[model samples]
Target: MMRSGPTPDAGDLPFELPRTTPRERARASALARALASAYPDAHCELAYSSPHELLVATILSAQATDVGVNKATPALFARFPTPAAYARATPGEIEPYIKSIGLYRNKAKAIHAAMKDIVERFDGRVPGTMHDLLTLRGVARKTANVVLGNAFGVHVGFVVDTHVQRLATRFGLVAPGASITMIERRLMALFPREEWCILSHRLIWHGRRACKARGAGCADHPVCREFGSACELRISAPSRATGGAPARAKPAALKRSAPRRS
Candidate 1:
């Protein structure tokens, strides 16, 4: 199901938010504050030495894993180490190395265009500001967040990827169906600006390792303590103990139930 109602910005369709009460907002904020202290070591996993590399790495990371992207980027960077280099290369040349990533064609196009723009406008350097990066192809809020926080040490906004979005809803920090922008806005109202970058990274790590969509480990999780009333464990205990039948059928009991009518 989607989030409850229209957001503060109600111009869009499908209504991107649930109507959060003031009290609920306070509780969510408090929980976020506590979680910040709980997970302080959060950071982006992608490896990159320069701003341009981080930009390209984040773009390639779409629909792909950091480990896989990392494997491909070393050779990719060796060949096209800067925006100028990438801007000059043909898509055919880049595609062979990046073909393993999903949506390689689209990613290649985005990378080529973004590099060309960077070289032409920024003098072969990736821009640090959000507005500037947004102009680059394939640089959505998520990718911009990764580069801003990780590359420039600028925590302009929270990174609300699949993990962040899923865990936020499950933790009651957000309602359902909130857009990434809406979720980030709500979270930003609560978390300190200094911790936004690390918080996103930690949340992503936790979501990947513990709070997975399929089989979350919520029962004994340290973060489970502040889960409030709504957070539910993805795993459940055996049903037999809860006013249900025993696991095994006894042979003697089964035999006694048979009738021996002549």
Candidate 2:
């Protein structure tokens, strides 16, 4: 039987040595490969034609769906075609375009403030570096990562949104309640640096399509079978084991049978 250990704190390392085993690394590789194959065309779902547009859309995406942001940005981007244009406008002018989205007032203020910074500090261009991007209002690591990866093709870190966080825990990549910083660090250590940008996208796509928060459709997904033996959905088990009969196991037995990562 696999030994059970104390659940790690939110920011604590999964192990005392701060390292992953060969088995864990192999599983991570397989998981990444599976996700990449499942979502070969995975890209940022936000609709934008420029880095500035992507940045603004990303800012508006907080607590809002990508489709919702897409619906709002067409008119918003048309009016404020550039950072200078947004910088010239008041928050009141921007609010109407995005009022359909949640927290529109705050987002308008942030967009106005961020555009002003871009005009003043970045010479009417979106800053490419993570540090500079963070200086803008309402821009956090996730938004900076979206801009850096999709906009600039730079891979500084993994994007750990709600989908990524939920999927990572489901796959046993990190302990439950791990902070986003810890999750990003764990993912960076697991996958190659070049794969970091698209990795999040693929995971998000999978989370949205198959591995939903409420229920996972793992039975039809072979990649999940390869790397997700511990999934709550129990997809790894054969529908019929012996004598063409459905396999049945007790709840206690199933819990004990779950894989434990080192």
Report every candidate's CA lDDT: 0.68, 0.74
Which digits, one per residue and each the tens of the lDDT, describe model 1 over residues 170-233? Answer: 6655544556776786566445567678878877877776666553344467675455212352
- Residue 96: error of model 1 in Å? 1.4
* Regions more than 4 Å wrong, model 1: 1-39, 228-262
Each prediction's total of clashing residue pairs, residues at least 3 apart in sequence or on different chains, is: 0, 0
Question: What's model 2's overall lDDT?
Answer: 0.74
The total number of steric clashes, by the backbone 3 Å criterion, in model 2 comes to 0
Clashing pairs in 1: none
- Put down candidate 2 lDDT per residue, 40-74, tens digits, no spaces: 99999999999999999999998888988999999
Off-target runs (Cα >4 Å) in candidate 2 are 1-18, 229-262
Clashing pairs in 2: none
Q: In model 1, state the lDDT of residue 55.
A: 90
TM-score of each: 0.75, 0.80
